[model samples]
Target: MKTRSGKGNRVGLAVLGLVLLAVGGLAIARALGSFGDAAAREPVVDAGARSFAATTPWFWPVVAAVGIVIGLIGLAWLLALLRVDRPRRLRLESGTTGVTEVDAHPASEALAEQVSTYPEVRRAHAVLRGPSDDPHLDIGVSAEEPADLGALVTRLHDEAVPDLRTTLGLRRLPAMVRLNLTGGRRTRPVH
Candidate 1:
């Protein structure tokens, strides 16, 4: 849960501390050795001088530590990007009583059960509209065949408004049963 900038700062500080420790340790060792006076110590002195002028063994450790810190910073940045880029997941369920698995029921079944009680609606379907409205029921009806479209629309509006209000206890229904007419074709399976 740490932010990328915070993670980077922590890693940078840790690496800097380690590099400082290594360099300080080497300098202290050289300074201590220089205090001794002896001809036999000449090579040691020369080596220490050369090491001070040139890169020490600690150089690679510092580089590796810095590399690790940079890698960690990059990794944290990538994770933050992925979190923002991922799509959200949605979960839907019916608010009706005794309907445990609304998703499992076909759209036709849901429409028939919930909206078809009115004489106007002949067929109904539950549909999920992604990035549009929330989950809703779409109904298909026939005015020419045994039902009237105006009456059906009115009946559906009346029943749906109150049914959804009382059942879901929502101030307003999020979706409505959209009615369509097709000449006697069997309603497509809701799933």
Candidate 2:
């Protein structure tokens, strides 16, 4: 994969270099021709004017050469950006048919199930915070009501902690349930 990408970039750079060189050469050629024509007329004209026309050819070639060099430098910079490696998370796959399974499913699933039992909880998402060495979880709980923030935290702690301990065998549950009050519930009309 790396080699293929590198080769592609090289090919692109080569094409760009060729194009720039061609343009530069064309520019220089045109300038030189113009200068030559002016110089040929200079002998019939004045000495000062002849010198000025002679210097014109040198100016255009220098400008064209600088443009080509700048284009090459820009191409190199773009290639460097393309070649940089991006960081990615490692995913685990099942062996038989190569299906991907999420890491620490049991714990997260159990937590979600338990949190959903509360009447006030509208929606909940359990996410593992860290890697294996020292792991934690951030359980984001969207609530139906704004009341009882303290009570909700205590209730979740009381219910989830013991259940996680028994079912998932998590000795130290570094699980934090953050309650986000979405809005108040709609009131039903009296019949």
Candidate 3:
């Protein structure tokens, strides 16, 4: 859920991608060379198997165990990539009846939309995190050129925070709002 963890996952994937690409390229090159001369082609499995057969039986077990460990490590990396954070459902009180459950996505999206309406804002994203009863709003926003950072923060604190709290029927909602400036290419001045 943290930014560092997400970055680490990406780094792992990139390393794996590079390794696979190198291995595949080697295989393709070997295959193409083999096509030119059938006699030059070597038995891939037989060569490795014969070498292993000459070694002690214990060596085979050690090699197999190392392969299994590497496979498990790869599996763990894959599972981390596939992980999805499930947001908790917010419970709403009805008229002297059982509570109604609602998905937090709608409310979060609406809040994000409101934030995005600011003149300086280019894009905004919001997600409800933590416990359903006491949730945290995680917002990411990108701003246009020459945007006033102070004013933006003030507006989010004064306007957006109250709006979200009142609309969601909560006393306090902890928020993490991340702001970034949008990139724009500079034009060269001509004399």
Candidate achieving the largest TM-score? 3
Which should have the higher lDDT, number 1 or number 3? Answer: 3
Candidate 3 achieves a global lDDT of 0.82
Report backbone clashes per prediction: 1, 0, 0
Candidates sorted by lDDT, descending order?
A: 3, 2, 1
Candidate 2 residue-wise lDDT, 68-108, digit = tens: 99999988878876653421221343367774534465666
lDDT of 3 by residue, 19-38 (tens): 99998887777777844555
Model 2 quality (TM-score) = 0.43
TM-score of each: 0.32, 0.43, 0.55
Which residue pairs collide in model 1, if any? 107-190
Candidate 1 lDDT over residue span 1-191, tens digit each: 33666788679779989999998886666656755545434554577767765667777788789999989988986676555321132233446553333232343355457765555455455443332123333445444355576677677677754664344333444454555665554577786
Model 2: which residue pairs collide?
none
Full-model lDDT, candidate 2: 0.68
